[model samples]
Target: MIYLDDLLAATEGRRVGPSAPARFPAFCYNSRRLRPGELFVAVKTEGGDGHDYVADAVQGGAGGVLCQSPPTNPTVPCVVVPDTQLALFNWAAYALRKYDPQVVGVTGSTGKTDACQAIAAVLSTRHTVFRNPPGLS
Candidate 1:
C-alpha cells in the first residue's frame, strides 16, 4: 500500500479536495476496472481525457486521483500534477526505489526482445530476474 504523503512526494503533486485517504492498495488508469482503495490516474490520451472519468472512478470507490487539472468541487482527494503521464512514471520509479534493486533498462528500435532474453538469462544465474515487457496484459 502507498500512503498519501508518500504519493505526493513521489509525484511532486499537491492535494486538492478533501483530505487524502490514509493509503491505497493499487494504482489504476481506467475507472471501469478500478477497485476500492485504488488510486486513479487521470491521463489525457488520444482517445479520451481520463479527467472525464474521475467521477466514475470515485463512484466506483477510488481512494484518490492523480491528475493534471483539479476537478471542481471534488469529492475525493486529488493530486494536481503538471503532467499525469510523467507523474505515473515518477510513481513507478519511486515505488521501485523501495526494493533497492539494480535497474537495467534495455531500449532500442529493434532487437529488444532478443536483448531482454539474453540479459534475463545472464541475470538469472546470479539473481532472481523477472522480466515484464510492454504489451503484456
Candidate 2:
C-alpha cells in the first residue's frame, strides 16, 4: 500500500477536500475499473477527458484523485497538479523506489523483438525476467 503522505510528497500537488485514507491499495486511471481505497489518476486522453469520470471514481470508492483540475465540488481528497500525466509518472517512480531491480532496455531499428527475447533468456538464468511487451501502458 502507498500512503497519502508519500503521494503528496512525490507529486507536490495541492490537496482539496476532506482527509484522505492512510494508504491506497493501488492506483488506477480508469474509474470504471477502480476499486475501493485506490488512487485515481485523471488522464486526458484522446478518447475522452478523465475529468468527466471523477464523480464516477468517487462513487466507485476511490481513495484519492490525482487531477490537473479540481473535480466539480469534490467530496474525496483531490490532489491538484499542473499535469496529471506527469503526476502519474511521478507516482509510478515513487512506487518503484521500494524495490531494487535491475532494468535492461533493448532498442534497435531491426530485430528488436528477437534481441529482447534473447536478453530475457540470458538474464533468466540468474534472475527472474519480466519483459514488457510493446504498446503496453
Candidate 3:
C-alpha cells in the first residue's frame, strides 16, 4: 500500500487537510471506478479541469488525490506534481517494477488480439500467463 504522506513527499506537494495518514492499494482517475482505498489522479485537461472532480472523488472513497495544482477543497489529501500524466506514468512504472511481471510489448495496425492470443497460447505451455481480453486494445 502507498501512504498519502509518502505520496505527497514523493511529489513534494502541499497537503490541504489535517494531514492524517491514509493508504491505498491502487491509483485511478475516474471517480465512478474509484475503490474505497484507491488514490485518484486528477488530470487537468482542455475540456475541463480534474480539480473540479476532487470533491466527488473523495466522496467516492478515494484515499488521496494527485494533481498538478492544489484543489480548492481542503478536506482531502492532495499530491501536487509538476505534471499529472508524467506522475501517473512514473507511479505506474514503479508499481509494475514492484510486481515484476513479465512484460510483453505489442504494437500493430491490425490483429493485435490475435497476436496477443497466439503469444499467450505459446507462453502458457511453459509459464503462468495472463493476457488481456480481446478488443481491449
Candidate 4:
C-alpha cells in the first residue's frame, strides 16, 4: 500500500483540503476508470489536462487527488505539488526504493503479450509479480 505520507515525502508535496486516506491501494489518471479509494493523478498530457477532470474523478469515487493547482473547492483530500507529472515520477521512484521490487521489462515486435503473461505466471508462484496489461505499454 502507498501511504499518503510516502507520497508527500516523495513528491515534496503538501496536503490540502479535508483529510486524506491513510493509504492508497492504487492510482489512476483516467477519471472514467477511477475506482473508489484510488488516488487521481491530474497529469497534463498532450491531448488534455487531467486537472480539468478532477471533479469528475471525485464524483466517480476517487479517495484523493494529486494536482499542480488545487481546485476552488475539492470535496476529497488533495495534494499540491510543484509539478504533478514530476511528483508522480518522484513517487514512483520512492515506491521502488521502499519496496525494492525487481523490475522487469519486456519488449518485442510480437509475442510480447504472451511472453509477459508467461513470465508473470512463473514469477507469481514465488513472488508478487506486477504485470502490465497488453495495451498499457
The best candidate in terms of lDDT: 4
Candidate 2 Cα outliers beyond 4 Å, as residue runs: 98-137
* Cα lDDT over the full model 3: 0.73
Cα lDDT tens digits, model 3, 33-99, are 7888677888878887777888888888877788877766656677778888887666546646666
Every candidate's lDDT: 0.83, 0.80, 0.73, 0.85
Residue 8 local lDDT, model 4: 87
Q: In angstroms, give how far residue 9 of model 2 lies from its true place.
A: 1.0
Off by over 4 Å in 4: 111-114, 121-127, 131-134
Query: What overall lDDT, based on C-alpha atoms, would model 2 receive against the true structure?
Result: 0.80
Q: Candidate order by TM-score, highest to lowest?
A: 4, 1, 2, 3
Q: List per-candidate RMSD values in Å.
A: 5.0, 5.1, 5.0, 2.3
The residue pairs in collision within model 2 are none
Please give the lDDT score for candidate 1. Answer: 0.83
Query: Which clashing pairs does model 1 show?
Result: none
- On TM-score, the leading prediction is 4
Better of 1 and 2 by TM-score: 1
Pitting candidate 1 against candidate 4, the one with the higher TM-score is: 4
Clashing pairs in 4: none
How big is the positional error of residue 112 in model 1, measured in Å on the Cα after superposition? 13
Candidate 4 clash figure, as a count = 0
Question: Model 3 compared with the native: what TM-score?
Answer: 0.63
Q: Alpha-carbon error at 4 in model 1, in Å?
A: 1.2
